[model samples]
Target chain A: MCTYRTTTLTVAGSGKGAEGWFPVTDASVYFDHPVHAPADHTLNVDLRNPSRGASARVAVELDPVSARALALAILDMLDSAPAGLVDAATPSGVPPAG
Target chain B: MTPGDLTAETVTITGHGGDAVEAYLAQPLAGPPAGGVVVIHHMPGYDAGTKEIVRKFAANGYPAIMPNLYFREAPGASPDDAAAVARAAGGVPDERLVGDVAGALGHLRALPGSNGKVATIGYCSGGRQSFLAACSLDLDAAVDCYGAFVLTAPPDEFPLQVGPLGHLVGDLSCPMLGLFGADDKYPGPEEVAEFEAALGRAGKDVEFHSYEGAGHAFFNTDRPSFRPEAANDGWERIWEFFGRHLSA
Candidate 1:
């Protein structure tokens, strides 16, 4: 069955796609039929930069367990970072204070 | 150009709103005038597997074409990329799908040596679209392979723009065939039954088969869901059904 449900978010990051590195502005995550995964369905994610064209995308298809683990690991790494260092990174469109 | 040989190529056709859409067309070089088929790719987008299906129809002596439903979203993009873009935007709109399929049917009919008969065959989401097209167009036959959301709506949380198509059964313009897996939860046995009953009540011609040991995507050779036994039999049924309705 094609799940047809997707979670999309605006993301700020750079991803290496077929054409090279591009600023990714969006992310779409879904669990449905995979394009190349061996499983019937996998947790699929696509980081994309629509302004750069559809080819400007980085995609990954992971098993449920792996996807959960990866999600937790990302949160853990973020939590472990120094608070000051995390705060120093400017958010999108904000100018750094001199 | 021989009876057993087929030619496959990419061509552009006007789709919804007269937009140029990319499509893959396959036809036997030499064969008696026969019916054509419009192959609808599953939600995974127009990848190699679906293209192979289009060629299969041609190899079996039916000229076939598959329009890239995502062409407008991502022209020249890889199949996976285009699929992602489309998915993020919510699945294709039903109105647009109808227009694109109408264009495809027109293209098939205009092909040289056309028998003036055409049918539609779709898998997964394509299956639902196949039924939708049949309700909206003049077709000889329509095949629905495990298509969901025909009798029941998607979960409320789902972002898909489509809805149950039961209301359109009365308008179906062609004979219909449905192939389903007994274990598929989306269109599980109950949903399939309801859809069949509705069609019957509408006084429409319909046939259905449910394979006990198979689930969704049994015909997809590249996935773990592929059930050779079921897929093989399904192919046989498709050939028989098409032969009955599509052939001159």
Candidate 2:
């Protein structure tokens, strides 16, 4: 089994999938779960009041090869999710978008 | 070109309907504009962060221009209103976007200190605009940071779909650097494959890199989605690619 260090990152915004932007809320979630479980791991991302908003959750283990790849995935999410798709005007929370 | 000196100026240029595009232009205070860079804004419109990006470029000795691409649309329409606009104009033809980009290029060339050699760099919606500029404009290079594609299908098209970017590769004249995240739904394996295939066929130089463990929109520092490592890598690549193709 591979050793993994997990850190939760807060993301606040509004939409469905990864395209949701315009976050009125301060949302936070761990960028990746401890997938050192050897194989693949599944983590649940709960977005507070997601309602028609974009929701995306990915579990990545910080391995030698996967580090850069995972970092790029986060960038892609930000690239696709512009600030126009969200509905929250002044959101303040760090819950995962379920 | 001064390594760190920067000059900022506000300029207005004619836009569609003769509506002026008010932009903040920046470049190294000491050098002739090595090349022109039109920085496209995110979908939410121009904000303080967007302005900061322009200044960063100016400080780097590149004449950077960030136009209000959404100035013709709603003024940062509220969340409730944004949905309606996306539903309505989201399907707008790419040709229209090309025209707008052309207008921006025209303005950049007309700047008293500009040298006319130009490149396009876009973020999010601006990413799409950057790619479109590469397709239609005679740009020297292009940097597309996780831009969505125009598959020309219905609104239900999945971000993973590859059919939309077919035309983009077909029309590309210059090399492009596509920065994406491996876990992003928009640039899933299928989409990357499609772009790779297109680049192979066109014999165009295209570099596609995906950062693992990251999700969508990770390059924007103003938001929590920012991944410092990935953003730095992408930014480094952008500068290298531009220097290789645009700089003498």
Candidate 3:
């Protein structure tokens, strides 16, 4: 089934895409059919730069268990970073003020 | 059918709002005037697999075309990326789908070898769109392969609330062929029955087949859910249906 549920957000970061690293301004996450994954449904994440066009994207499709595990791993790595660093509160999708 | 080779290529066609969307067209090289089919890609976007389906229709002697429904959202992007973008945008709207199919129908009718008969066939999300197009347009025939939410909406958590289209059954402009898997939970058996009932009550021309041991995406040869036996039978049914309605 094609579940149309999607969560979208703007993010300030760089992702290594097919052409090389590019600034990513948007991110979309959903749990639906995977194009290449054999699973019926998977948690899919698309980090994109709409300004650069749709091809400027990094995509990942993971089964539910693996997705959850990856989420925990990401949080753990961020938590272990120096305090005040890697904070979600920091403004994004823009260059920092000089 | 006249002796001819199959030709397939990418082209551009007007879609909803006169937008120039990329499309794929396939036809028999030297056949007499032939009927046409409009193939709608699944939610996975207009990928290579669906292109093969378009080519299949050509090889079987019917000219076919598939519109890149996500071209505006992700032009030149891979099918998967385009699908992700389209999904985030709340999927394809019903009005846009109708417009695209209408354009496709008109384009088909204008081809040099056209028979002036056109039909629509779709898979997954496209299945519902096919039914929608038939209800809203003047197509000759429609095939809905395991389309869901035509009579029932997905759970509220999914965010897509396009609503049921059963009320339009009475407005259907063409005969409909529905193929489903008894095991698919989306349309399942109950929804398919309801859809059939609505059409029946409307006295619409409808034919439905549910394979016992198959499930959704059974026609997708690359998927884990591909059911060869069911797919083979489904293809046979499709050919028979198209032949009866589309042969010039």
Candidate 4:
């Protein structure tokens, strides 16, 4: 089944694609049939820099369990980071830590 | 051009609004004038697997073509990249898909040795589009392989731009063959039954077969969903259906 459900967001980050590193401006997450993954359906994530062209993308297709684990790991890493360092990493235009 | 030899190449064809779109065309090197098939790629975009299906049609003596549905969104991009871009924007519009299929039909009819008979076969989302094209265009036959959102609407949570096409049954312009996996949740057995009933009510020439124990994408060789027994039988049914309707 081609689940037409997709969640998209604008992100400011760099991702390594086929041609090395590029700034990624957009990200789309969907649970659907994968392009290369062996599973019938997987959680697919495409981090892309549309301004740089379609090839400027880093993609991942993970099983649902693995994707959940990865998501939890990301949150854990962020939660465990030093508070000051996390605040310092915020975008420059944003207000500094109160 | 020896008999049984085939040639597959990339070509440009006019699509919706007369826009030039890239397409893959495959035809037997030498054969009698035969029916043409418009192979619609799945939602994954125009990749090697779909191209292989196009070639399979040619190998079976039918001239086939597949327009890159995402070419407008991401021209020159890799298949996966193009697919991602297209998916982000929203799936292809039904009107645009119809126009593209019309263009592909024209291209097929214009080919040398064409018998002027054409059919459509699509997988996944393309399956629904195949049914859509058959409803909107003049075709000899159409095959819908596990196309969802045809008999029933997607769940409210699904952010799909398209809706159920049950209303188009009366407009179907050709013989239709539907192959489905009984276990598929989208167009589950109940939905398939409703669709079949509607087709019958419309007095349409339709044939449907649901393979037990086979889920969606049973014919997709590259995916884990491939079910050889069902896929093989489905291919035979397709050939028979086409032969009955599209042969010169």
Candidate 2 stretches greater than 4 Å from native: A1-98, B16-19, B75-93, B150-154, B157-165
Q: Residue by residue across A1-98, what tens digits does model 3's lDDT show?
A: 66766788888878999999998888888887888899878999999887787788899999999999999999898789766555534475333343
Model 1's CAPRI class is medium
Candidate that beats the other on TM-score, 3 or 4, i.e. the better one: 4
Runs in model 4 lying further than 4 Å from the true structure: A92-98, B1-3, B155-160
Evaluate every candidate with DockQ and list the scores. Answer: 0.71, 0.03, 0.53, 0.67
**Judged by lDDT against the true structure, how good is candidate 2?**
0.60
TM-score of chain A of 2: 0.28
Using lDDT as the yardstick, the better of models 2 and 4 is 4
Q: Candidate 1, residue A55: CA error in Å? A: 0.7
* Candidate 3 local Cα displacement, residue B194, angstroms: 1.1
Worst 10 residues of 2 chain B by lDDT: B153-162
If the candidates were sorted by their TM-score against the true structure, best first, what order would they fall in? 1, 4, 3, 2
Residue A51's lDDT within candidate 4 is 84
Flag clash pairs in model 4: none
- Candidate 4 — what's its lDDT? 0.91
TM-score per candidate:
0.96, 0.64, 0.93, 0.95
Interface RMSD of 1: 1.3
- Tell me the spans in candidate 3 whose CA falls farther than 4 Å from its real position: A80-82, A86-89, A93-98, B1-4, B154-161
lDDT tens readout by residue for model 2, A1-98: 00111222345545343454444322222222221333222221233232333223221235435656666898887567657433333354333354
